[model samples]
Target: MHDLIAAPFRNEHLVLRPGSQRAVKIGAAKFTDLENAVKAGRALPGWLVDVARRAWGVDTFDRPAHAAVLVRRPGPYEFSRATWELNLGCDFDCEHCYLAEKRFEGLDWAGKARLLHVMRDAGVVWLQITGGEPLIDPQFPAAYQLAHELGMQVELLSNGSQLGKPRMLELLAALPPTKMSLSVYGASPETYDGLTRRRGAFKRFTRGLDAAVAAGLNIDLSLIITNRNAHEADAMRAWADRLGVARREYANISPTIHGGAETLPSQSPEHLTQRAPFTGCPAGHTFFHADPFGRASICKVGREPNIDLPTEGVAGLARLGSIADSLMLRTGGCTGCQLSDTCRVCRPMAKVFQEAKAPLKNYCQHG
Candidate 1:
């Protein structure tokens, strides 16, 4: 708090893009201009000073903290946003879970911090911490705090069950994230409990949302639609509105990470009719996922690691193109379908090629 506002200011160019134009350079003379502005009573955060220094001809390897910055990015799929599976264990037994039940394999606290440092070295600007339930992960809180301290905007994709606990609330108050996308299964206790099958889960969910909002943390509700609760989509959104939180509704269902079909979504024909233009997947191009253990993949459901994270750092990103190329083969239903022209499907790379699993029969209305 030593007059960070009045400190000497330096304007620096932050490298926001990754490609032929690798480093973004900002001149120290420009920094002198900003410092002149600061001397004239303009205020800015201490972190901006670090950013300016990193951009003013200082090599990135020297300053790990000033990794991400504001600039026109390279593409949506660059390693700009990273997703981490902090743990594969969850307290509640949800019906439509994407993660197959697996033994708990988590990185120790030091390992978690090191992973973030490596991602920062590769210039990841945004990070998402998710899991079977990231809140239950032993190293999650510390790892999350480290990401924010490293100058990355962090978000948590949580089920919101434990958000109201004394320890959980304390952690949020200490290290609030950019936002939390709290998954709300249904609008009612009966619907929520029926989906989650955990006693008092509905009460806990609401309590967690309320606690997060009270602590001044940005909170958003994500209502996942399954056949059992499809009729109540409006009610769930209404619940979010009542709580004064932003929300998004998810209606698509995907096979489990292991290609298991038992827990698949019971989507209706009308839901399958919804369509969007087929742009090439952002996966492998710019986005990548990592876990605490040895896994790294292009997408969340696409968990057959094309490249290992713990053993390989940013180098793994270079191989993503090969993985994406191998996935575009003429597979079962996609061989002659006209709808493939407009279908926004990318998981076949995981299911058909990597897992050797058959094409997900109910994935779309192409049949």
Candidate 2:
């Protein structure tokens, strides 16, 4: 368990502490020297020792560089980030969930370990662990620990439903995430429970949220505004302010990943904001998303023609750049449309809306 990681991030060299956002930039020469020191099991560099102490209050002066710091070797790939869906199962059945089905099936421990290693080899330095609710996964603790051990800064995306458990809190305290993003459905139990279609959902959420705050975990609230709970948006922001945590609001609802329109009705029309016009993205070029089964796609929205990472390994990622290019092309109904010049949704997202048979006004500017 090293206290910090020194790695090459693309063209830059960065020294980073796991679970902390503090980053120290060093020249290429210094990065190479630190790497050599770790290889030779040398004592911690005086400068780094001072840096750790001053930045994080960590004392590494007496520790060997090899024992106290992990020096990450750069890989052939340029990817520095990724998001993995551990499982799709959730305790709550939110009406606006994008997944049409919430199955608990996914890779076993062995498969998961292999996929994570593949991600690490692909140069993923920052990994987001997500799911219908990641904390509820039985294998979460070991998997999270393994990600950190592999020198990847881990972020957790959860509903904060299971965060109140003693074991969960203890695990977070020992190895904090880069950030824990919790979804806030509502401020009160009635609206929250109603939105999630679960009894006592709000109670459990607040309990876990408060526990996380008290434990000093870096947390951010995702204020999910829906037709059912849009009235509580201000209250949700106020709650985040009271907790002294950061928050972002998400009011627009999308169709399910399976192209079902069931979730569209939950969108709060008044709160829907205009999306910027479609621009270029670096989804597969710089980062990718992996499903529970280790299927790597350009992103969460563009799911077809994915690579099976566990079976094909990291080598298969070579095809992603081309796949991303093809997915972004204006095709299908978007081809030659006069509004294409000002279209807000990307081709993949537009395809989803078209499949769901949603009204054009919901996704197209022309409507």
Candidate 3:
């Protein structure tokens, strides 16, 4: 019921509002003061009440701390962000999808609710709910509502196929996500439908996109460029520009997460740009990913040695940092390559490419 959330982020304390971008950093004393006020059922402090009204337009002037704020207890685990795949089933079957098998399997509603709680306890604040198409999942509404109610800033990643539906639009309009990231496949229906291998798919996507924009929901576009739709790349960019929404293009296609070569042929070789060198990442140190079944991994690209959140709970995450360090070691095909300075792919991704038996040209500078 509360709109405000106060939580520990790494070593600092932060006050965040769901569906808003503003974050206020408070000192340790103010955090403890808020905790005491909530414990005693006292009204919020004057500064915090003013911050509430100014930041999110919520007036907590005379409101008790517990009534207006959900204070997240500090946890030993330091993760602050996570991505959850609601389901693997999608309305459109894109050829370049990373999931090799899009079998519709996931945790049931009860399990999903419990997993969200586990995430909260692990100190997650920014949550991305994705899927083969998350909007198509049956329990998406309930699960998304629960995430919001738990004081997590939710971001929805979808193909924009279901956004046209009245109920879907209504739910999002009522409890808006931080952003709706919709993937744009092609500029024309013929190209779009052909690429997704689903007839009438482009029409449905356009409808959903228009509806979302009209509803005043925050949206960003992921322009997916593949060999099938590479010719329409300019058109896609122009369309996104015309819409005046945030847009980014993805030209690199990777092997499926299962290390299958089925999706590699869709890569547009001409459009394949060199990625920046693999600098260090904060995958396990600051963030992690969760599959539909509550399995947690360092990130989407590195799935091995993951922990089952449903069974192991938050304590299971303690090993991820170590797992990440082991996964990043230069091993196998990458051992003694001498091109470590210019390596574009991380070790986990390189290992996936090796498993897929993809051509060295696809992922290595050695080619």
Candidate 4:
């Protein structure tokens, strides 16, 4: 059974068999072998055959054993983390805003509560609150309180527009350690405002940053590096410096894949072919996104119908569990890609842009 399952990769020097439940000496060290053992003149067990197929990268097996051995097996769930989008709408109209055409709607109190309960019960420890600007939602404060009450660490992805407002300030003052990630497109108002397509947005963003910093909030910066502003990396670094922050606090890169098709130039298949090493996407495994429609997705872009989150539930825990399983099984394009560590090509994002054949325009190689 083991040999049949591993026929394709038999030359890879991977062996599978069963023996006493003791450590097998492979080289200088002893390692415990957990595969099924072979009995005297007996057929392998069916269960062991299945294990060989999954653990040894074999596609087929007819027999089973009590134990087996192989050169490779599934790795531990290292990226077993999760991130949630608190809201979908954003206040700015940046040129690269992926969901630019989507309506700027906010979730209601009941919806927020239901979602929170679902996340809490699902053992999701990391939560991110985002929106057209989360502060726009009056219930946002209560949402934060609920997340804290449920023992989940929260992060805020905001444009910093309303941070300086009196009510928003009061809300910030009452919250616990919520990390704030602010988007800084350019160093100057002209560049930043032009990209956001809003006049005076730069002033509002800076004011909010100052207010958050003065209030002793944990803040980080996110930058969307684009052809228009790639040259400003050093200047943007200088801005972070003046703010008494580290350069690593900033995330600057262009959009390789935009959710809104009308917002950017089309990319060809040749352009979409990734030149860098393919790192496995850890979406369903480490992170997940729930759209306003209540659809759960792996990495905010996966579109396979069966892999998508069910929309019936508010918290989407079942969807999360399914996603985790799908990730473990390596059932999508992720399983075919070799770049599982260095590439940021998210399955969800790729699924969204698959029809368009968009090139990996985002930060493909980390600088």
lDDT of each: 0.64, 0.92, 0.91, 0.54
**TM-score of each prediction:** 0.76, 0.98, 0.96, 0.63
Number of the predicted model whose lDDT against the real structure is largest: 2
Model 1 lDDT on a 0 to 1 scale? 0.64
Number of backbone-clashing residue pairs for each candidate, in the order shown: 7, 0, 0, 31
The digit string of per-residue lDDT tens for model 2 on 233-264 reads 99999999998999999987899998999999
Candidates 2 and 4 compared by lDDT, better number: 2
> How well does model 4 score by local distance difference test?
0.54
* Stronger candidate by lDDT (1 vs 2): 2
Write the residue-wise lDDT of candidate 4 on 1-367 in tens digits.
1232110111122232221111112321111122223333234544444554565455544443322222232212322235555666667777766655646564566776776665554445457766656766667778777766554556777888988887787766665344778888777888888878889988998898899888877777776565555567678878877887634422322233344455444222222334444456556655666655444566544533322223354233345547545544433444665555555544454444444444445323321
Taking the tens digit of each residue's C-alpha lDDT, what string does model 3 give over 1-367? 7768898888899998877778999999999999998999998888898887887788645568888889987657889999999998988889999997798999999899999999988889999999889889989999999998888999999999999899999999999889899999999999999999999999999999999999988899999999999999999999989989999999989999989989999999999988899998888877999999999999999988899998899999999999999999999989998999889999999999999999998889988
Cα RMSD for candidates in order: 7.9, 1.2, 1.5, 16.1
Better of 1 and 4 by lDDT: 1
Score candidate 3 by TM-score against the native: 0.96
| Model 1 quality (TM-score) | 0.76
Off by over 4 Å in 1: 1-78, 268-273, 347-361
State the lDDT at 85 in candidate 3. Answer: 92
Task: State in Å the error of residue 327, model 3.
Answer: 0.7
